[model samples]
Target: MAKQHKIIHVDMDAFFASVEQRDHPEYQGKPLIVGGQPDSRGVVAACSYEARQFGIHSAMPCARAYRLCPQAIFVRPRFEAYREVSGQIRDIFWRYASEVEPLSLDEAYLDVSYTADYNGSATLIAKAIKRDILKETRLTASAGVSYNKFLAKIASDMDKPNGLYVIRPERGEKFVETLPVGKFHGIGPATEAKMKQLGIETGLDLRNKTLAQLTERFGKAGHYYFNIARAIDERPVRSSRTRKSLGKETTFAQDITSVTELTTKLLDLAEIVLESLAKQKLNARTVTVKVKYSDFQQITRAHTLDHSIALGDLREVIPMLLARTEAGKNPVRLVGLSLSGFDAGKSEDRQSQLDLAFSDPF
Candidate 1:
């Protein structure tokens, strides 16, 4: 029999807002938002727990967030400060587990299946990591422990804001039975709605569907859904996954038609994409512009250069790409900028380009 894997997913509690509140004592326990100003055409990058109580969430328009809670404090993101703290947290991960897969700056998955620390108890190790993080950084973290990544990720969210929840091997399938299909990590909003239409509201509802039935509906993702419903996930915790693309995009609360407004938004996106590239020390030869019209029609225009793209290059190329589409003439609801052609030397069969969803409200 194959041995079960032990995985722990650690997620920081309201990372950006918590960091801001920690730095400014006056902001503690108060609703705080980290993104652009309420007056600017920006979205909420992150919000405090207090802010969430007012029905505010990330990717919401700052203007709407202001309307939700006029007393909420809005501030720009301090990426440098957040990165420093993330590095510190990563250091703590290394001390506990040799295999750590970081999903983002504030969340990671650690495989402690073979670690003898805490007498090989993944649950104990998770607790220790959480304690160490709070002791060193004065920040709270929530953790989920389970035998596989799928359940582990779900368990992490069961109790949040300095929580540690565990799903044992015996209870994994049972735990998923009552979970809403919408809460499953891989199922997005659109998929959840479709599932609801098909009467797949919970894991048990999904589990009742035969492999053939599910495959007929969800295609390749059907296999994943079928197995996870039974609490079986064979995927390993890959420590060397490479980032293939980095992109940023924003959805406007109201559709925009002005060329000047579109250009301004593109420039803002470019600045953010450039900063991410500089931070990761990466360069790309391909840039793709995504435009979604008010009618929900979406299109993309791409330019591939012989050399890496720079700010000056974007300034020159973006307008030309926009011209290629009917962006200014058409009312657009979303605009995206993506950088690809990262020169990771892996074989084509082994390589997959993953697009990082843009969460920076522009």
Candidate 2:
């Protein structure tokens, strides 16, 4: 029999906003927002608990957030500071577990099934981690402990603002039965409505359906749903996840069919993508241009380079790549560009250098 994996998921509470407040105590209890300006086309990247009281959250349009509370404090993101803190937290995780999977700068999953430290108690390790994070950075982290990745991720969200919740194997089945279908990790609003239409509102309701019945309705996702509804997940907490690509896109306020107009828009997107690559200090060997017509028909054209393309060369390469697409032939609604094929070694080196630069020497 395979050993049950002990997993811990740690998610920072209002990470970006919390960092901002810690750095500037005056904003601690205020409704603070961090992201693009309210007057621009930016969206809320993260908001404090105070701002959440007004129904504002990450990814909401800044304009709407402003309308919700014009008095809220807004500021741009400081990625350097955030990355520095992320490194510090990851260091604490490393001391307890060798298998740590970072979901982002603010959250990660740690697998400590075989570690004998703390007498093999995942709960004790999680508590120690939260304590260390608070002592080192003056920021709070919430943790969820479970036997697998799926349950651990879900458990982390049960409480907020420096919370720690655990789902023991004995109660896992009963716990899942009462959970809403939408609350399951992969189920979104659209799937929830579909399940509701089928009279499956909760995990117990979902478990009532046979694998064949679910497969017939949800396709491949049905097989996944059937297992998770039973609180059985075999997925591992992968420690080496690679970033495959980076890209940027924009929706135009108006559609245009002229080639000249399309070129102008594509150029703007290329510049942004190149700037992102420069910031990461990486190079790419492939370029792709995506186009969506006014009718919402989307298509992409890609070009692979014999050599990696530099920032300055993109201005010339973008026009060449755009010519391969159907941008001017139809009214275009959106334009996007992407770059990939970075050398894995270089990317790792760049990340290490960045983490060190942001970390405190003391």
Steric overlap count per candidate: 2, 0
Worst lDDT 10-window in candidate 1: 353-362
lDDT of each: 0.84, 0.82
In model 1, the clashing pairs are 41-362, 43-361
> What C-alpha RMSD separates each model from the true structure?
15.5, 15.8
CA lDDT for candidate 2: 0.82
Q: After superposition, how far is residue 258 of candidate 1 from its true place, in Å?
A: 59
Off by over 4 Å in 1: 241-362
- TM-score winner: 1
Cα lDDT of model 1 by residue, 221-270, tens digit = 99999998898888888775545567666667679999778988988988
Q: What lDDT is reached at residue 159 by model 1?
A: 93
Highest-lDDT candidate: 1
